[model samples]
Target: MGWLHSLFSPLKKLWFRMHSTTQNKGRGIYILYEDVKSCPYEDVHVLWSILVESNSASLPSKK
Candidate 1:
């Protein structure tokens, strides 16, 4: 597996680093590998919308 893996590890790491930040960036998203038991997509979406609305409300209005 060493030779087969060596050629791909760097590429995998580079891709992961490049595109993985969105999965978790402290805004309000998370990846639960384990069983979450709660907070399904709908719930998360509602929460996300709420946060966005609150944030937008806090911002000054534009003409």
Candidate 2:
């Protein structure tokens, strides 16, 4: 494997570990490697929605 991939592989595993636990159950979305980096034009909107939703969920709610 290339050095760059070797570097990212561990990070990806760590991300999955953090998000796939019971604490985050039902709140995680998994995308295949190919689909994420080279997503088709038709699927761009889907990716955008996921990003927006993740960001919104991370923000604190106003009183």
Q: Write the per-residue lDDT of candidate 2 for residues 1-63, one digit (tens) a residue.
A: 699999999999999898778555544444443456577675876777788799899999999
lDDT scores in order: 0.68, 0.74
TM-scores of all predicted structures: 0.35, 0.35
lDDT of 1 at 48: 66
> Model 2, residue 51: what's the lDDT?
84
Model 2: per-residue Cα lDDT at residue 12: 100
Q: Can you write out model 1's per-residue Cα lDDT over 1-63, one digit (the tens) per residue?
A: 999899999999999987777655643334332223365767766766777689889999889
After superposition, candidate 1 runs with Cα above 4 Å error:
1-40
Span of 10 residues, lowest total lDDT, candidate 2: 25-34
Clashes of 1: 0
Range of the 10 consecutive residues with the lowest summed lDDT in candidate 1: 28-37
Task: Give me the displacement of residue 40 in model 2, in angstroms.
Answer: 8.4
